[model samples]
Target: MDEIQLTAAAEGMPNFNRRKALAVTGSGLAATIAAMVAPRNAAAAVVVNEAPVTRVNNLAWALARAMDDWMVDLGVDGVPDIWKAHVYPYSQRKHPVAFESLDRSPSPSARVAELEAAFHAEWAALRAIEPALNAAELRYMEIKGSRPVMGEMTPEEADRLRSTTVADLAKLPPNRASVEHAEAMRAYNKADAAARRKTGYGKLDRAYMKATHRTSDVANALLRHPAMTLEDLASKVRVHRVWEYDGEDFNFIMDDIARVAGKAGAS
Candidate 1:
């Protein structure tokens, strides 16, 4: 695969299909986050610790970024010029032992594992409320006469669409919402937002944001990481193999992101 796109690569494009912020129902994305976050072992091994942890990932991002910057300054032969421009310091900075341990510790370090656990907890909380919000969006036109709050989606339908976005749900229906529906939607959304917030999803949102930033930091940092050659970078960021050596496209594609989006978010 020659220069295949790093679907979620963070140079220019940002959100890495945050809906799937690390893992799916429980697969694939762990590696994606791992690739960028924990480059050494990269979450390949099973995590045994489930202690509540925080800031570990942010620190990990710090170290990986430091490593990448270090390599960039070394003027590693294969490093991309834009990547050199991309790193902030153009030289490695000091890392705390805790942060450096993110790379040095065993694969899926206890802290990393705890971070993932926290992520899943938050991800689940957000998902629990989204279907109702989504159903409301899909059924927006009938709100005044429709169900009181939710869009009336069945568990089966919600399950099928668990991964679909509000926009995706909107696309499935042919109902033409009148301009008045926008006002209705506004009220409904206000109530919905308040109700969702009442469920304490704000904390969840903040936690996921931290994890994702760290993960994306890892992805961007990899471009500067010493072990990651351009070839390695090419392989890690790809959605999948297309034609053999078809060519690289490091740009992030929204469509690809949606395809892999799982039940989570960075929003």
Candidate 2:
């Protein structure tokens, strides 16, 4: 992609899909908070000892890795540049899209298994902090909702709650922290792209067109999935064999491919 188009594409897309953040439900609130506030340099340490112990971690990682590997298996070279530019550094929701795409020749299912295992291990360690996490959450909630009255509650309860909340807020969970770090990185990229776009990168519309066209093609292929009829089969082949060759048309092609693939399975 040319500098101008690259700048525009980067700026046009969101850094991370906030929708993914909705995964933080009920009890997972602690996990979410932890993930957001934890320190970067301490991820490994925290992963080993402080990460949230939830089944969702493994599930999320497995699916993420599988999706990424599947994209690579379909043959788009080197992590979709758009994802790298706009998604990867902003949140775990999108990071796997690029990393597993670049991984060499692993079957999508296999990659999924690998990531699932890794997540399991990490979560096993993370769950250990549940007690502290819950305590902190309760404390933080109390403090934020209403300031503790001097004599409304026992001095010990007040002290414990305040101290625990302070600690929790001070050190966010590892996964949560990673997400925030990625967000900051994405913000930086956005700023840089905006600056570049303002500066004369505006001329690279052709490159953007080229990339988006191929992306659209992949999308079309995915849409044509489940090829039951000869017509559908032909369309799939045409899209996959012909248009798929052009990266600019990839998105459309993939869409058709997915549609056909889905239909085929149903049949």
Candidate 3:
């Protein structure tokens, strides 16, 4: 039954491999989504090229990818309400929605409202899981934040370090402030590692990363396509599910989601 469902879902998608389909739940997941999300040039050796390329051409498919994500995740027939309001005919060939999405904000009112609601919901979920603590992380921040007279500073580095926080310095590079910032990171890494005795999956960070740092890459590849039936939706979710990012953060997906959501609203 699972095999049948997966096979059916793969139909009409750009490329589908039954053997490669993921089981949709487990500790192991990679690749199936890599195919769906693969760059256009990465799919296969290009035998053909369309002359006079344009932005709409690139966006036409990206729009599809964005929608595929929406359909599978939201289980909705259309994209968010904001996107639908922006569409123009293909002949007109202007895309305000795409511009705002790739850059930022849909409309001031809509984008703010949408992002606020989405982020509020997200933080609510994360806060619910809180009271979480990691002594190692705290220790890392502390050690990294320390300031002391050290031999390694150039006059510029020393001057900057005295003027600003180490955290602020870390964001600068090839500059006066960056010197101590890098040094601080080294101290922090050493202290953090010694404190934790483990570098990865420290429990709190992992869950936090899942909730915060994730990327959303798991929508079915069909793009702007709707599920034909309940079984179809299930199949789409399955073959599509294990294939890509389940916990992808909003930032990575915001552009695409905004594009599709706006596109859906255009009609």
By TM-score, who's the top model here?
Answer: 1
What range of 10 consecutive residues in model 2 has the weakest lDDT sum?
1-10
Question: Candidate 1: RMSD over Cα atoms?
Answer: 18.9
How much is the lDDT of residue 18 in candidate 3? Answer: 25
**Between candidates 2 and 3, the TM-score winner:** 3
How many pairs collide in each candidate, listed in order?
Answer: 4, 61, 10
Q: What is candidate 1's lDDT per residue for 1-267, written digit by digit as tens?
A: 211111111121112444544346334654554443343233324333533243345544764675575434323364521222122221442211111111221233233333332332333333343333333323332233332332355565556567668877876542233344656777776876665466545445565556555544443333223221223333233212211111232333233343334312432
> Model 2 scores what on Cα lDDT?
0.39
- The residue ranges of model 3 lying beyond 4 angstroms of the native Cα positions read 1-41, 44-48, 52-55, 61-82, 85-267
State which candidate, 1 or 2, has the greater lDDT.
2
Candidate 1 vs candidate 3, TM-score winner: 1
Task: Report every candidate's CA lDDT.
Answer: 0.36, 0.39, 0.38
User: What CA root-mean-square deviation does each model show from the true structure?
Assistant: 18.9, 21.7, 19.9
Model 1 gets an lDDT of 0.36
lDDT of 2 by residue, 1-267 (tens): 111111111111211122233455676765655554354225436556534545346645655665454444434454432212222333444222222222233222332233322332222222323323333444444333221222244466456556666547656343443566566667666664554454423234334335445444443434333333334433333234322344554565556567657777898
List ranges where model 2 is wrong by over 4 Å.
1-168, 171-194, 199-218, 225-228, 242-267
